[model samples]
Target chain A: MNSHLILRTVSKFLIPLIVVYGLYVHFHGDFGPGGGFQAGVIVAAAVVLYALIFGLDACKVAVPPSWIRIGMTTGVLLYVGTGVVTWLLGGAFLDYDVLRNNPDHPAGQHLGIILVELGVLFTVATVMVAIFYAFGSRTPDISDEDW
Target chain B: MLNLINAAAAQAGNVPPTLIIDICLMAMLVVVAFAIVRIRSLFAIVMLQGVYSLLSAAWFVSLDAVDVAFTESAVGAGISTVLMLSAMLLTDRKSAPVPVKKALGPLMVCVLAGAAMFYAIPDMPAFGDPDSPANTGPGMEYMTASVKQVEVPNVVTAVLASYRGYDTMAETVVIFMAGLGVLLLLGLNGNAGFWQAKVQGQNICTQAAPRARILTSPSDKPNTEPRAPGDPEPSSKNTSVKKVAAKKTAARKTAAKKPATKRTTSKKAAKKPAKPKGEAS
Candidate 1:
């Protein structure tokens, strides 16, 4: 499988671009047809493509399953933490209105939306990669030729 | 080019110009569905299912639900295909054929469902109807409020991340829990202790790198991961990232297993060689 020079070379070229596009989709969501979930999926797809070309062990080394566990927790925390912060800031739960207080500015809402979306991005992406690892790491009872 | 423009103008009387595309996508979707039902090969079925999703995503785009289209393509067409393929690797390639009588009941159910859909459609608003119930009521309110409060250009993002932030957070939590559940059921490996080993290794490396450094040669990167487990013998614990390292660990483990297999064989051979015949009750 390592003999697949074409796939290896092509993926090496494409993965960075894919990741950049995912970030673009994330940041541009406020003005376009994309969001955190889509961005996360796109980024995870890059990692998955790398895993497919390389092997599961190599990917585990690169992304490290331990980090994935941490990422899953971190993303959830970041999301919920925003709401808790909003609550602590004297607005209702997830009320982005209190995130910042320039009396005439929409800055609070903008900041809140970005933080929460970032959180969504993290959880969705890491969960996707974790699930991929679970499936890919299996020593399949069936083989490629059989399938 | 003129004929194309004329065609667009002709169809622009009331229907959208993309109506042909909608029809074509729908027809392909039906064909793919039937192919999925008829195909015995699970691999082909999985591929067709992905194609089905892609077609539907295109249909969503045509219907102006671009946000939904984005999600459908990413989740359904992209990741679902990969996950399904990986999962299908665990099972046989072909699906068992259902008996005609068994399928007949499902066919009746499908017929009834399709009939109900058609029956309901007449009472529903036409596609993209501006005055539809969904377009009015709370929808208008959200649209207006989103502009005034969030100042976000995309109302979908505003609604999802602002107005319905709680629901989205819950969904994120749900995904997190799903990951945890999968890890628990699968054990990150088919074994019980690998995840524990990896986590312990990380803490060791981070907390005491200098002390841990004394135990390994520069080349023993695999040793780093397996050292912290302390469960397997030191020799068999070279679970490195490289393929060579993996093979070395596997060979070591197998060597350790050789005598265990021999003992099992000896135990089986020592069992009584008595044969008994049973009569049907």
Candidate 2:
């Protein structure tokens, strides 16, 4: 992979754009055709591309396995925490309206969606990365000649 | 002939453009599917599957299901392809040939399922019909009130994240559980140390102890051991060896100064390699 100058240079150029696009899709999801799930996948694809061009160890060093594991758990916690907070605010579980002081407020809904989407983004991205790490870390039992 | 064609085009108006795109995409999808079935190489099949996903995403875009299209393109075409390739690295590239007799039962089941679905299709309501239950149900309410109620322009997001928040939460939890399951099954042994050992053709204990030793190995002793067979010669290995050596020396010096630090360092050194040794074959 290090010998392939073309791939390394081209990927270095493309990775940033891909990541930026993923973030754009994430934050602009409310007004656009993308959301947390799509954006998360896009971001993960960027990391995977980097892994493909570079190596798995390099990718792991860039985004550590432990951090990804933590991120996976944190995302679920964030999603459930939002629900719990709303419940504690004297509303039903996942009732975003009660998040704000004014019941039936659009602000509360907006905030709730943003938080939930963020949670989704975290879980999706980390899970995909973790899966990649798992698969990438293994030694291929077969060789190219076998194929 | 040109005049007749122009007249027909004028008559058809906006419908032809979309219909043409739809037909083209569907034809490509069918071709890709056939290729997938005909090909014995798992690599080519994985690539064709990604192509299929992209084609379907294009179709979804034409149908105005842009969000679904985005997801199909990113997850189905992109991440899944990479994941499949990664998994492929562990398995054989060529699929084992199936005997005709062995395949017949599965083929019959597939045909039966396809026929059943086709038979049910005509009973369904027309696509995008206003009177259809989907359009007339809560979807209508979401479309009408979501902007004002949720202040989000994307009604789908508003509905998913706010109105039907519980369902979305459940979906997230499901994804989390999947990650947890994979981690539980694969994560512990899926580290560089495990693979390094597997590559070197050494027993697990010998491999594990060396890594701990490498971490605590004196800086003065250069890693003069011959490179493993088939391992690539890269400069990064030299740098990494030096870095590891430096850290180990620093740790040793600190341990000499403080017996308390020595106990903690020794405990960590003992624990780190022990876990991997227990799991490694």
Candidate 3:
């Protein structure tokens, strides 16, 4: 059917746009309706879209399990590490005030928020993909006729 | 229409036009939810669930919880549907209808719980009540402080990332654990021999017909390998390079009885297994 061809062509076109939009949402959270959580899911949806079109095997080839694991770990570490850094800087745990030099400017809060959100982006994106992989991989070999 | 005028008036904050949009969305949601309950096909149910999620996401946006709306659509409608479809492949497509007797207890519980919630609704603050405790409490402090101290234009991000950092971190940990649980239940390889998977495996998930992929796309197969020609095709044109255990072996057992020839019928027996080797190894 032309539907298959359309899906393939459309997905190829849409994947990059989705990923970029996800990044936009990630960075633009401060001024608009977004955050790391939403951004991460959007980015993962791109990968999921890729998987749906190209097949899960090809999808996994593009993003391996090991890389997914690293992403999840890095996201959590980056988040807590910022907290630990703040603690080391002599503020209460997760206090963003110590992140900047000048007390007058909200620079510390700004930096801390960005870093923490980045961490959330990392974890949320990888976890969603990882969950997808787990489910996708475990599937039995069902053909199109099964429907 | 008068309704359009009412909607516009509501937007100007004088008339609270919650009923128009909210009623339409809620009615659709209820219908979809009921349809999902009655549907015998798991596939249809999954699709309906996505519809429900989208409806709810739109409702969330109407309620001014744009952030929540964003998540509900993506995670709930987008990813969850895909995940459910994949998971469904492993099970029977049609769900067995539940016995009325067996369903009664849960149905009663649901009705009672819904009744209790409805009764409690009167005590709850009206939507967007500025005098409400939630709006006036430390939540107000977070909002005001975010502008002056955090300087972030969107207070939601400021609250989630800064003021409620620990809560967000805990939520992240919870997500991480959910991933962990799925990984434990289903190996990323989805193969029986988890250890057998090579360091540079071509595919992790055997989603579609495994061997069919290699046949359809020649460039994807490593031409250097002499075994490409001998790789057991699914006979019926299924795909996957990973050795799916059940069907292939049964097919090979029959093929093993037939003499090994390089024809389509002689798929399984050509190699070592008397039957065709399901994998390249």
Tens-digit lDDT track of model 2 for A12-126: 9999999999999989988888878887888888988998878665676677676777888888889899989999999899878888776555688777888888889999999
Per-residue lDDT over B74-143 for candidate 2, one digit per residue giving the tens place of the 0 to 100 score: 9899988988987776666789886666688889999999999999999899767889899988779889
| lDDT tens digits by residue: candidate 3, B53-153 | 99999999999999899999988999889888877765567899987776888999999999999999999998889999999999999888789988999
DockQ of all predictions against the true structure, Cα-based? 0.47, 0.42, 0.51
Best by TM-score: 1
Candidate 2 docking band: acceptable
- In order of TM-score, best first, we have 1, 3, 2
lDDT of 2 at A64: 67
- Ranked by DockQ from best down, the candidates are 3, 1, 2
Model 2 misplaced stretches (Cα beyond 4 Å): A102-105, A140-147, B1-15, B102-120, B188-281
Label model 3 with its docking quality class.
Answer: medium
Q: lDDT per residue, candidate 1, B164-188, as tens digits?
A: 9989999999999998988786544
Worst 10 residues of 1 chain B by lDDT: B207-216
The most accurate candidate by DockQ is 3
Per-candidate Cα lDDT values, in order, are 0.74, 0.74, 0.76
Per-model C-alpha RMSD: 12.9, 9.7, 9.5
Which residues of candidate 1, in runs, are more than 4 Å off? A140-147, B1-15, B102-108, B192-281
Best by lDDT: 3
